[model samples]
Target: MPTTEPARPAHHFVAGIGAGPANLSLAALGEDLLPGGLPLFERQPGPAWHPGLLGAHSRLQTSWVKDLVTLVDPRNRLSFLNYLVQTGRIYAFLNAQFDAIPRVEYARYLGWAASELGTVRYGTAIHEIRFADRFELVGADGPVATAEHLVLGLGTHPEVPPCLPPGGLPGVVLAERLDATLAGDSGATGGQVIVVGGGQTGAEAVLSLVRRGVRDIRWLGRRHWFAPLDDSPPANDFYRPAYQRFFHNLPDDVRHAYVGAQVLTSDGVSLETLQEIYRANYEGYLRDGRAPVMILPGRDVVRAGARDGVVTLWCRRASGGSERHTAHLVVLATGRRPAPLPLSAGLAELVELDGAGDPIVDHDYSIRWKHAPRHRIFVQNRGRLSHGLADPNLSLLPVRSAIILNTLLDRPAFTIRDEQVYTMWA
Candidate 1:
């Protein structure tokens, strides 16, 4: 009998690293374009999009129309509207008359879409990506799959601040873990809680604690005030495709300036959330003698330590001096950074880097690498500085995916028309 040769690993026309909304959007748009569906390697045991952060009353900041496949291809089967109709909730959803759909509902929609796609490989973590003739996706055992091209959508993780103690103090948790921490018998609900960070996560954490009947909550923030999201027409224009094109063409210095100026468009808390938090604080004040949530803005937590089962935060005031605050529990909502690319040392050597040592991503979101002419490495949610504020936002998911798909196929696979734009960026 002839000896059988070792079987070659499974191959894909293209593969994605993470099954988050970015890759999900890309997979949805590329379903028909590729011969086989775009295979996705998701480390998650199952479909999940920020499950921990999806509070009972949390709502999406972006419109429901900005789902995985609507903006670029509304007729796609994975559209949010299609998900509603297929799941027999179209009428019920319409009847609810929500200004913005609940965040939990959006998460469910994403899970439904992922199941429908049938291309995602759950529980498979790609340890290292090595490039040869094609890209080899290495798992724990060995190379799991090979792909001609790769799309990286490895989403962000909860950012822990440097001020945190080295080993992490007891009762200090990330914003995502705050709910679970409170739900457990952690004795955190009985005492003072400090929520650090001024963004939406911080706001939500404060709101969650308020609803949990936790009094003496100190909300520390870096900004002068907790600002509401700028959802006005002119502000939204910055998220449009026309503006994306214009912003991409600007000089690096100009792009940096524009991003700094437009921070509120993407980073501010929702007006509804702010109103609810303020209302909760006021009502708590009326019910009790003191407010439950004390908003402490212009605070930069520079150092943190724990003593006697309590966490102490030394915060530098924006105006003058420093202040000390002690709390039984501390929640960090200090925003997130991109997950590092897991490339083999030899493979990483081929990639070009910018002044900041980050991969030099192009306008089309493809990283500048040695094998760019043939093999492409398109990145998602990692091009905020290079592309625009919309790069990481849900608002332009479909458009960004479309651009990457078009670049991959070397054709205008989907038309990204933004003709109605009235604001002219000079």
Candidate 2:
């Protein structure tokens, strides 16, 4: 018999960066499919999703069924149902009769799922992903690990508009920190507090301030009115796989325009949240002779600067002319921009960039890179323009993960059955 040599074991088949819901979904679905396991490199100490924004009353915008694995692999060990049952909260959760699950519950669920995945490397933040023979994820300390393939799901960061003033301002804060800041600041309730933006976060900030007994709150919006989210059945069809596929085939111009037109579908505030704000405002007015919330719609904050103790804001009104407001506090609920891909000079150059300078993500959510065939670099939540709004949404999370897994495995690992199509998307 001829002597045989032992083969060296590879580090990992796929290494995911940032263990947010998107990548977490991919991890749960593809865990068994990938050899050597698809480990996640998360910067956070542990699984914490939107920690700052985990308000007591805040709820998820999507349904509980749109969990990490249910949409694709319901029988998966890491499914939300399994977590609920294992944690002995399934009955309690069901009995609550919540239209949408609490944001904290979802956060806890993510933590549970992350805990079950033994391959997840928490507190391991990758500095940059450099490619040579394979992908090397380097952290600040030194080389973290290497893998044959890499997936980036770094998610989004709070976007501070250039219009906003300099940092270190006492009253100026992000929407995520609004609740905490207000709790400690005693004088804000009596002072003029301005909240900039009309999205869900903005609404939540306004609601939080109102609940905190803030008497003078000016909620500014660029739109004509603070529009409620279009959660209607037909509107929801846009979030389905069929619509996503339809959108993928459209011309760049058309896709861009459609996303723009359907802005309220994803960006608008929930109807329930909006109603609560209104009711709170009404009650506040009845209790004290003045309404707490002053919804100033059709106004765009063009310029902002803080000096001394006051924050000055100049708005370009839609009706015409500019108006100014000086407030003791200003909270920006502007929005979030996707976190930058931490790819090294070598790897970054290999990836194709679109006209907008974003990575050209294919239908499978893999970036069209130089070594894509052998070593794919999949992107999650950073493909709004390329993959449609649902790319970042939780509604189709498992479905998207399954798509990526199927593509990576080169087989129908997850049989995506999105049938009963009634609407004809043109």
Candidate 3:
């Protein structure tokens, strides 16, 4: 059994909070490079991935190749391939005929990888960050730990539409925690459901509720039809050496504009889930002579209200017209925004920011501060504007991990130490 080390003072090192995929990738990479390694803190009691939305039909938007560790170190023992082998699913997965596996399975894979790593502190919530001679992580229990480096992986938070009033009605709920919210609901069998937003999560929520035997459901979106994502396979030249050169040489404003254009907001449905939804809707339409589910496209929801278990929605039509509709349940699949960090007054004053309050990071993702020179504070998901299109996605986990690792080690090339490798697997 791996023993837990007591929290003690440490020298120059990196400390990661929130062990999501982004930070988990860094932790796995750090394991192979730093011995008696860095500390990772997670608020959850155990490894859980999007526990609020972990439905059976929920699947990943990207390929399985985009796992935590494989994108960086394919040969690492903690790779997804290794997880499949360890779980005795390698052969079964090969025969399953899936281009992308169910997201619940991927969540399980992440849990398995985290268990193997075994260096994270669970159930510890970091309250605030203080920058002194070094970075200090103050938690609910006081200063939990201090380090020379800090990486924030505090993922996105659910975004409730500003048009809707606070304190949701009895039947209205944001779709972030769909499963828990809808569980044990006898009313949902024949209840009407109105789902807002046109993103992948929105599509998944609609499909999930429909499959659970909801008779009446409607999907409303501003787009005429679902937009597909850029299906071009990994442009190795761009993501690799040549593209880095091009990106680095480009003007700052130009780089910002380019990334802004490719933002993945409601980017298409996965081929698997798309087929399932289309087929189900078509079959229902044929059987009943009318679709139980309605897809109202090219319309923006101007306002919404829920009272007495009925939701009244006011929509502005695409042709400059208006309409009103009502449903028993309303699901706001509006997606998420970046979680806010509670910075201390002193620390907040020192850190530089743009007009929008987003931090200014260098190529290594370190937040630039006026006072702190030796202590490097890095942000994981908060660099969308400066870091380009791959800011918060799983696609750039390995590359970002490499950049952070290089900065921590102060080395141009990251070479794995023998002791680090042994400690990681042991």
Using lDDT, give the best candidate's number. Answer: 1
Taking all chains together, each candidate's TM-score versus the true structure is 0.98, 0.95, 0.89
> In terms of lDDT, which candidate is stronger, 1 or 3?
1
lDDT score, candidate 3, position 336: 80
Worst 10 residues of 2 by lDDT: 162-171
In lDDT terms, how accurate is model 3? 0.74
For candidate 1, write residues 242-357 as lDDT tens digits: 99999999998999999999999999999999999889878887989788999999999899898888899999999989999999899999999999999999999999998889
TM-score winner between 2 and 3, please give it. Answer: 2
Q: Rank the candidates by lDDT, best first.
A: 1, 2, 3
In model 1, residue pairs whose N, Cα or C atoms come closer than 3 Å (at least 3 residues apart or on different chains), thus clashing, are: none
The sequence of per-residue lDDT tens digits that candidate 3 reaches over residues 1-426 is: 999977674443778889888888888888868655656888999998888677877777667886776655788787888999999999999999777688888889888878888878899888888877887888897788877778888898887777777776667777866676677676665667888877788888889887887758898887777555455544222233234434555677887776655544315566566677778888888987766578777778888877787889899888888999898878888768888775788889888887677788777888898754477788897665666556666666777887888887788544322221211110
lDDT of each: 0.92, 0.87, 0.74
Clashing pairs in 3: none
Mark the 10 consecutive residues where model 1 has the least summed lDDT: 157-166
Q: List candidate 1 stretches off by more than 4 Å.
A: 1-6
